[model samples]
Target chain A: MSQTSRPRSRSGNLAAEKLTYAAMLTPALLLLAVFVFIPVALVIYGSLFDFGLTSRDWTFVGLGNYVEAFGDDVFWIALRNNLIIVIGSIVLQVGFGTLLAAVLDRGVRLGRTLMRTIIFAPMVISSVAVGLIWLIILDPNVGPLNAVVKGVGLTPPKLGWLGDPSISIWVVLGIAAWQYTGFMMVLILAGLQAVPKDIYQAAALDGATGLRAFWYITLPSIRNILIVAILITTVGGFKVFDLIFVTTGGGPANSTQVLGTYIYLQAFNIGEMGFANAISVVLLLIAVGLGWLQLKTSRKA
Target chain B: MKVLGTACVVSLAALAIGMPAVAADKATVKFWTLKNPGMAEFAAEAIEAFKEKRPDIEVVYEDFPNEAYKTAIQVALNGSEPPDAFYNWVGEDSARLVREGLVMDVSEYGTEPDGFQSILSDGWLSTLQYDGKQYGVPLEAVSKFFYYNTNFFAEHELKVPDSFDGLLQSCRDIRAIDEDIVPMPLGNSERWKLNHFITMLNERVVGHEAANPDYALEADDATLFTNPRYVEALQKVLDLQEAGCFQDAPNATSPELTRTMFATEASPMIYCGSWCAGIFNGEGFEDFKMFRMPEVKGGDGADGTNFLIVQGYQISAKSKYPEETVAWLSHLVSPEMAVRYAETMGRVPSNPASLDSSDQLTESFKWIAKDVSEITVPINVLDVKLENTVSEAYLDGGVELLNGTLTPEQVMEKVRETALKAKAKLDK
Candidate 1:
């Protein structure tokens, strides 16, 4: 009788534990299914058809839309611009952010909070606001930057900073870096602060001070945070829209066009929802690939 | 628990019973328009006037920013609660809506005794018609012109250019006055500004006979947009650039900034739409004057052929109050409202009969009104006239053309290639 009772209690506990797990996960899984999975599935499904946003009729085109995107000149230009933005952002935001974060961590002796706040101020401003501010500052005729450039006896870009196709994308990249670099600095700075002073002291005894200590101890300690900073920058870079939309509008002959704006142009402006969907599928695959890479990297870390 | 449940049911029942009665007394006509300066005020006036004319029909008004309005209008039309009557540009965009069956035929309603058709002509009606059916009530037209600073011309002792060649020489003369000055600061950053120039140039150089066919995509692919004069029209724009008519970086400049340049006397001339009259005035620069896009020597455009985009309102097919919405639109475009429209918005009203009666009209507004009345043919703007794909090519080409990155032949080559694709797609 005692052995039978013991088995019964154990079974009851197991059932309760399984119930707890299901109860915790159902709402989250339901939300993910509704918001993420279903939309992604629908997007992929829509890519196989030719349809307008308002048109009820859908013509199945198989892989025709994707093939069209591959052949599209504007599509290639937009994808190239996106890649430029991604790489430029990583180098400018992450590379400079590490420098600034290290300086704020130990180099600067005074106004630490003030410098941090000033550098990070742009991060708090909305991207649209940032774009508007930059637009005014970069105006060809009236912008002070041009005046300053001329005053310094140097000629500005002949087609204006944002007007020249050769240089406009780089200007946009610089503007993006300006907005995001400080945020990266703050993120890395927090990670640096978490690093113990004892490690630095030990490194100093080994004749590893300043740049050498930073290279050995300071960097190795914040390795995971820097990886995260880079990951965030890469994702944010691909997803960039409002800034480019507000500034160049993928213009000066589609020179500044990115994948996000191009997708919008096809879907809303051109009314080619299916083509837009195909582009969105490409973006989604890139995002998934990046996410998987991040996951693998985290596992290695 | 019983008392609370009973109270909740009673409240819901009261709401349900009251809603239909309220809806019965006043059928709502949701109206949408692009948000421009003074447009909201004009729309509010229209709504108020509509209430007086049709007391039973309540007009609900909504407006969106000009850039956002295009997307908003399309999205709203596809949504569950679409506007009953929304403002639309009269061209390919309006035609596409008709093709998609998103808008109503309104032919029968528009032809009724109190409809807009009674006051409007076949030409004005033709602007919004597809397949001989009127789909909209013409509100106003936006015409393009060269707004020259009167003081600048006066100070420099310059005559207003009358021919396209004269215009180029005029740019040279102005630049001669001040080599550092941008004779005409054309901000083509958005690309439409320069496209507007080329649209008028194409009409001037080749006329509607060659363009309309290619524009309509009825021209055979071999000859599609292959007109040598189409390149000549782009060449005319390039000629302007070479004469130093524009800034070194025209492609990067904003249209608004260009407008301000003329308004603030930073630039002496601007090829601007008639709407600039109000803006230049509002910016406290009233000593400016406008002229038609000067004649192109050896061109086919008639003496009075000019840029005029007929913008108006269309009733949604999904509207529950189509008849009432049509009435509301008709009232908005009536002679009395047209006068108020011209006075309030400083636009060229469709019906200018009552414009002289409105003593509130600006001298510039009256001048534009008289000039618009004398127009022989209104060439709809190319960006709005052409189908999306071709228009996009034109816009992008305009940017490249201004940037000096693409020559006239290259620009037209790209445009022709795009037109061929668009024509093929349309043929299918």
Candidate 2:
């Protein structure tokens, strides 16, 4: 009699609880369906057609857009640029950010807060504004930089840093690093703070010292946080657009064009909405795939 | 609970009743324009005039910075609420909008005798037409020309260049005097500015070919980039850079910077459009003059033809009050209005009746007009596809050439490739 009564109560409770949970999550679920899921579904759908701003002249050309994208030289160039930016950020931002964070943690005797604020100030500025400011600073004629170069008693050959396609990539990478290094440093510093000082002391007692202690104790302790920072920077690097658009405009002749700006140009500028969406789908997949790998590797570690 | 429920019901009912009534009583047209020092004032005056004519209609004027105008317009047009009437860059931009049917067919209104100038001659009307129908009313016409600082020229005792050789020699003389001062500040950073140079060369090389009935037919049938004239025109730009005639870091230098340099006499000369006349006027440049860029050697019909680019206004297809918008546009395109616009903006009028010169006009303005009037060939309208493709390649390749990374042939090849792709896409 007792077991039958308990089962009856539990079944009734489960029904009420399910209703309560649905009611609580209804708004969020609706929002996700409208904003996120629907747009992604549309992107996937749109990639199958050859639609533009004008006319519903879409023909269902399965994988045609993808095939064309692969063959397109601009796509390859933009992809190459994206890879360069990703690798550059990882080497410069992550490596320098970690080293800087460790140095700062060791307690520099200088104005640490002031240094930190100065380093982080760029991240606080809008990317567009940052691009413009750099454009002015890098100007050959009126810019003080050239003036300094001339003041050094050398005939300064006017370098179109942004105009020259060969050098534009490096300039853009430099800008990305300048803006993001501080952000990465802050993340690393926070992770460093979370690291237990006792662990380092214990390692020292066990004959671990200097670089050895950092290698065995400090790095392993903060490995998860570094992974998190790396994942964030990698995704951020892939999605860079505003600075590139404002500074170089993917010029002097589409040389500095990134996938994000290239997608924008394809969709809005060229009115190739379907083709642009296909590129976006590819970008999204690459990002997701990379992020998944990072997470898996971190978890295994 | 009853009181709260009652308040919600009342508010919802109020909103429901208020919205349609507000929307119906007065038609509001959102207008976007580039920010200029005096444009807001002009827009305000125009709005007042519009309001006086149509008491029931209201205009919501929004202004954006010049640099942000393109992105802002694109976003605004695609947004939940779009402007009814907006400023647009002419040429490929207008064609894009017209093709999309985003722009309204004001043909019925524009063709009306009193709505717009009936005397819009075949050549004049052709500029605004897309696929045989007018999509917009031509607001202003501008021709690219060489603006020189009169004081600098006088100081250097250099005459205005009338031939290609003379132009090259003058550049060398200017360089010899002061290497720091750029003889011609051709800024390649803004790709369009680079295109200005290319357009001038095209005029010199192709001559009447751009306006030729046979030329368009030929272009439609085959790629225009493969043509000898196209490569010859591109070569002239590369030649100029190699000669060290242009400013250092041409790619990094923007139009604004170039203009500022000219205005301050830092650079002796700048190749810019006649729209810059107002800028010079505003800057109180008392000793600035302009002349036509010299003709290229052995170029066909390379005489007096000046390159004319037009910018205009169009009503959006999605506009709520199409009639009112048409009425406003009609008033703006009238002879009196065109003259006013020309005077204020320092632009040439498309209407024949409004071409009267004023005493306040600069010497360069008169010279350009006289030169254009005497030309046997009409101003060239570049094929939209070839224009963007070649322009971008020239800009990108121009920098590399200047930096010694790419040779002239490579630059031409890159341009040819882009032009071929654009032709293929356009042909489809």
Candidate 3:
């Protein structure tokens, strides 16, 4: 085999190898065409029409759905809520995640595995379970949180945690932070452990140590992982549905409605498939544009 | 030995995998309903009697929870695996299925001798009709009212209020028993609970005939939801809230929890559906009585107008076994099954035949049946009555109304805006 891999023979096998590779890639390409590309094209096409899911008649309005979505106040509220969740998840989840990862990396030695496992346990649970658990905890009537608040001298919100319009979205954000911060921590922790220990040791020979070692050695080393973590958080924030669906259900006059839930409301609950597709297309474009911007900015950096 | 064992396993596995869904001679008819506790059992019993009548037909029963049932039925009807016949509320949901040509016109089947139409009254049969064509069988009607603990009412000397102001006063009188005693614990977290309240209130305040055009989305955009009485109906709900008729955090509490509250006698009153009678009885609390939502003062509604949500089954137009499906539905509304439904499910069956059987009707249900028969004007809940987007707005507006984030007028304004948008969309 080694003798057959001489330069002339290697050059001759290139076309055959290329053919084999094309044959191998055909299934994946077809799968992508069937699942991703075709559905996206259909969604974009459907967004231009006016139709119900069950109605046999489909009227082509040529961007009428997009027009309605833009003029719709609930659509704007949903977009604003999505942005709030993204920024807030990044700050609360990624920010605290970095700190926890750093502490677990070097500062804590005793029961390190135990602490990591405990901190990472919630990540194993589904978001729907997390939402239901927090729903009971934040419930105004029987939830322990309000009992504890009233036990002390403080007062809970008048309309309950998820019921109060002014604070329900923030409460949902906090719940998301609780459930997902552990995941971000584990991701960053993998990056931290991959940072060669000798680099920190060499830095310690100089003036860098403690918080300084973290700021320079740890953060800069895990920069790529941090970018990945932020990207994951942003995408999850935009697609958040189950938690908000189970908890607030975009209620108290839709103060907690995100784009995902609003799209579901338009599609399933209200039976406006075309209008829902328009909102979905808007979500898709925003996601693609932000992802492109992130990649470009990361590459520039 | 190993080869023989493998052959045995494969043959057994093949037998398990290729089992028939029903007897080879029987044609399967799919049935769907909401997942209430007793409904499945009652449906099974009915299917047993149906089997005795038609051994060649098999009924495959399925159910979904209330909210999911709506979406499930809609999507299922459009998909390849549509139900042979599915339970549905009798307003826009069923009518929309009719409009989309998804529901079968059982007019001929219904008009045959011993058909469901012959079994039920003209009014009961007409409730599920569209343009004089019968679309489905009317199984039952559920009405909402103030269900009070009989013992607590007697102890507190509380009378069932006949007027809206009197109801508020009743709330106050019950509150005097204890400040923390949620006089009537409303569970509006799903928003539909309050939607039911607003439905009757609107019926009482705006009158059904006047609000029908707006609800139907036939009124002009400029005049849609322009009735001042709509605001008054909202204010009535607020008035109940101010009177401490509900718990402090009604918008957060669930219907089940609040129903448990009333069942446990922690609360004396609950404005719940007629189905609560069965649930309360199942929970071992049977000392409960019912009364209609009181008429608002100076309102245009008639004396005996009440909330009557008619629900029934419609066959999918695309069902492969339409004859069997129609037979199954007809059997569902049969005299024996109607009695079973009333006895097991504690609802007012459209077919009142055989209700005189022993243990066929609970005392609480008998009152419901009498009131339903005597109802001068029947109004379905607004969520089922209104157009979809407008219904969504009404649901959200109800939550905001309870939250006090929006005043009654503001709530109506939001509803009016949504109605205008829905009307405009319809025109387009």
Greater TM-score among 1 and 2 belongs to 1
Per-residue lDDT for B1-428 in model 2, tens only?
Answer: 99999999999999999999988988887777778566677677778887877778888888999656876776666566778778875777777778767788767765567666364566666777887887777665667778888888887799899877688788888988987778888766766676667666767876665524322323543554455675677677767776668876777888898888888888788888777867877787858877777887788755557777666677777777776776666666666666666566666666636546455556655665555555555464453323444445656665666666777667767766666665666567
Model 1: how far residue B161 lies from native, Å: 1.2
Model 1: CA > 4 A from native = A1-6, A299-301, B1-15, B110-112
Residue-level lDDT for A51 in candidate 2: 77
TM-score of each: 0.97, 0.89, 0.93
State chain A's TM-score for model 3. Answer: 0.93
> lDDT tens string, model 2, A6-28?
98999999999999999999999
Q: Each prediction's interface RMSD? A: 1.1, 3.1, 1.2
lDDT of 3 by residue, B230-337 (tens): 999999998999998988888888888899999998998899998898889889999988888887889987778889999999999998888788888888888888
Against the true structure, what is every candidate's RMSD?
1.9, 3.8, 4.3
Tell me which of candidates 1 and 2 scores higher on DockQ.
1
Q: What is model 2's native contact fraction?
A: 0.57
Quality of model 2 by C-alpha lDDT: 0.75
Give the runs in model 2 whose Cα sits over 4 Å from its true position.
Answer: A1-6, A150-158, A294-301, B1-27, B64-83, B110-114, B118-123, B130-132, B208-224, B351-403
TM-score of chain B of each: 0.95, 0.84, 0.92
